[model samples]
Target: MISDEELMALMRYVDGECTDEEATAIRAQLAHDPAYRRAYNEVRQADEALAALPLLEPSTGFNFRVLNQLKAEPHKAVSPISLRKRLLHISGIAIFLLVLPSVLLLLSSGQNPVLILDGSWLPAVGDRQAQVALGPYLQPLLFVNGLLTLLLFDRGVLQPWFRQRHQPPA
Candidate 1:
């Protein structure tokens, strides 16, 4: 016939988990009920007995226990290198595409227009032309690829590495 609040208060008294206000309420109730007071006394005695029990340091194998649990767990493998390699390979290909043409035209052919279609630059580059042609594209592409690199590896590589490094060095 006890209310939830009353039962919880009684349980807290039993478990030695009651705050001062909770204990006061429970005490007030016990003053009105002799049977409840007896029960409360018994629980209080049991809680105090438990508190008086001896304490000991944790076992040496606790670290190993945690390590074993981690080892037992199955985790999904995520790799950013593949994506970065793809982007870098693409970027390298783009570089080879642009620069290779200009270099070959300047060196082997010596201003030949016939090999113009095959990776050869007909229009010579100037300072303004460099910025106008490739700067905008390359800068943004590199930044985006770098951001993608950060996103791909942050959860897998960065978080774990930082956690490992800062974990009290045990």
Candidate 2:
């Protein structure tokens, strides 16, 4: 049995890929070794068979047809506007579901609300003497809400407007 290296050398020789020195060594081996000669003959016959097959040519308009088919397919990319609108809706729902109820609860508590910080300047609600003590949370909650509102506005409204303004006429 011929080794894999010997078979590869025979294939390389058949393909004219072997160096002159390597080809000479393979030729000597083929003359002396019957197994080497048989492998070389098989490799050469397969190579000639492949070379004898006719080359295939595409029909006319093949490229155009492929391009047209590609264009006909709907694009799979998600639109930025739709994504922004979705985010805006989700944020709005979150604020309504989470923040609004807390604010309402705080307001409806009616008992003289404890003020953690000085709220003397705050006006009384109805006949109450003091303001609702929103504790240390009110300022931060309002600030976060303001920031979220700005972010939603930028993403939902300003970004799309700016993109439209900057886009080349197309």
Candidate 3:
């Protein structure tokens, strides 16, 4: 099948000059050929119809109304973190943590493990260690953060020093 460009070229041939080779071929095809004539007529009709359609022109007021509508619209705020993304982040952190010690060990494979301590906390840590060895009281330090938080509520919010401060003291 001939391309659209070839058909358009045939239309130009109808106007006037084309290469002798193209002209001769087109002449042979168009002569005594009703089908080729009909096809050329159809192409001319389609081309004319396409050229005759009205072109669009935007109204003078279209720009200002659109911009005003945009300004009147409330801006939407979207959360940066989703539950699935948060879970994926936590999983990535876990994977990093699980591999981190092994990676560090591999990097420092030639070095020996050494004790790490702060000089100021040595006495306090020793006192706690001695308490843990002796009594159940020292178990709180292992999980004192949560316990202390709840204990503060008990000591401050729930506990009553006078039992009736709202009423005049007897």
List the global CA lDDT of all models: 0.62, 0.75, 0.58
Order by TM-score, highest first: 2, 1, 3
Backbone clashes in candidate 1 total 1
Q: Which stretches of candidate 3 lie over 4 Å from their true place?
A: 1-24, 61-170
Per-residue lDDT of model 3, residues 1-170, tens digit only: 55677687677776555788888877787786776777777767877887799998778699777866774545545456544554554464555456556545644555443334444568655634221221232234324534544554444444433443564532
Q: For model 3, what is the error of residue 129's alpha carbon versus the real structure, in angstroms, after optimal superposition?
A: 80
| Per-prediction TM-score | 0.33, 0.42, 0.26
| Candidate no. 3 TM-score | 0.26
Q: Can you write out model 1's per-residue Cα lDDT over 1-170, one digit (the tens) per residue?
A: 55666666787777778898888888788999987877777667877888899997678699778777774444546578855755665565555556545544444543322321322343444222221233334445555655655554565466667976886522
Considering every candidate listed, which one attains the maximal lDDT?
2
Off by over 4 Å in 1: 1-5, 14-16, 56-170
Ranking by lDDT: 2, 1, 3
**What TM-score does prediction 1 earn?**
0.33
